[model samples]
Target: MEPLIKIEHMYKIYNPGDDEVRALDDVSMEIQRGELTAIIGHSGSGKSTLMNMLGCLDIPTSGKYFLNGKDVFSMTDNQLSDIRNQEIGFIFQGFNLIANLDALGNVELPLIYRGIDKKTRQELSREALRMVGLEPRIHHKPSEMSGGQQQRVAVARAIAAKPPIILADEPTGNLDSHSTEEILQILKGLHEAGRTVIIITHDPDIASQTDRVVQIKDGKIEKDYWNEKE
Candidate 1:
């Protein structure tokens, strides 16, 4: 199968001269479609830098990134924004939902940016909520739901557009074991149903649960292993 995401010679430098910090150093990797992969590293290991590149949130100093076969760096800021809004579904660890918006509203947020009409976005958001098994709580605000449910709302928001890639950054960072597993299961379900899911996490257990693990240290990849245990 063709690769869903590819990065070559990626670099992110914080300072120019005497005080140079390489958040990412010559990182290159390929992620195929529908694969569940984990990028694991401690704080300041450049994993987040990698995520920023993959999500098109930041441009690399020097490298190439192709998402679904389109060169990411070749696009302008507005085009990059469109790439983020259309091609990738982001689920952050923080949930990041507006407290004022109910689950349905939170799920509809992204669709609104895509110029989706109210009636269509509402139905799509409702279906996404149902996919995450949160249909009954769609009307509840984020503050009214458990950590897992809020994350589910976030997931619903992500998949509502049916993006080709699901980029999750420390998706379970704030949840208990059960909630973490629940969210993981939902991500896994998405992968099973043919979505490329990349998880950025520090937890070994979480990394192990993924189909493949790529370890990073000091801004470079240490090991790229396909988990036979899976």
Candidate 2:
């Protein structure tokens, strides 16, 4: 079977007048379904750029990218927007929740964009919040919950659309050890349930838990390996 995601010779050059910087250099990668992959690298290693491309948030300057065997660059703007809304979910380091919106509200935002009816959105959002073990905190705002709970809500928001792939960047960076472990368990559960999970982080400890690891250096992939022990 074909890979769920395939990126070939991808390049991203940010040209702001005289300062032309290459964020990604001939980067190539493929991620299979039902796998948790961790991308590790230092600052300016192009890991973030690569993540943006993989998440369908940014287009590459050159080369080909295919998500679910569909050419990413060939997609119309609306199609790409639809993919971002429906096929891929994103969890940011900051949680990125609207401060005033409660957990259920935040989780329901994406479904609302999809034009789903009110009753269906509420039902789906409730199911997603339950999946992340955040059912009890559905009505609580971000500031009203602990960091781990907020992150759990964020994860719920990401998965509410039933996206096939989840792109999480530094998911555990701001959490304490206990919270980190909780978040890790949640991600592992998602992966075990047949979802594709990709994380970008600099923490070796976090990378160790994933099923696969890809190291990047100076905008290029240095190593990619699968961990069968997972």
User: Cα deviation of 70 in candidate 2 (Å)?
Assistant: 1.0
lDDT of each: 0.93, 0.91
What TM-score, to 2 decimals, does candidate 2 have?
0.95
Clash pairs (backbone) in predicted model 1: none
How many clashing residue pairs appear in each of the predictions shown?
0, 0
What lDDT score is found at residue 200 in candidate 1? 98
Residue 131 lDDT in candidate 2: 89
Model 1 spans with C-alpha error above 4 angstroms:
none
Q: Write the per-residue lDDT of candidate 2 for residues 1-230, one digit (tens) a residue.
A: 99999999998888945888888889988988988999999989999999888878889889999888999999998999988988888999999999999999999998888999999999999999998888988899999999889999999999888889889999988999999999899889889888999999999999999989999998899999977682
Candidate 2: stretches off by over 4 Å: 16-19, 228-230
| Per-residue lDDT over 3-109 for candidate 1, one digit per residue giving the tens place of the 0 to 100 score | 88889998888886799898989999999988899999999999999999999999988999988888989999999999999999999989999999999999998
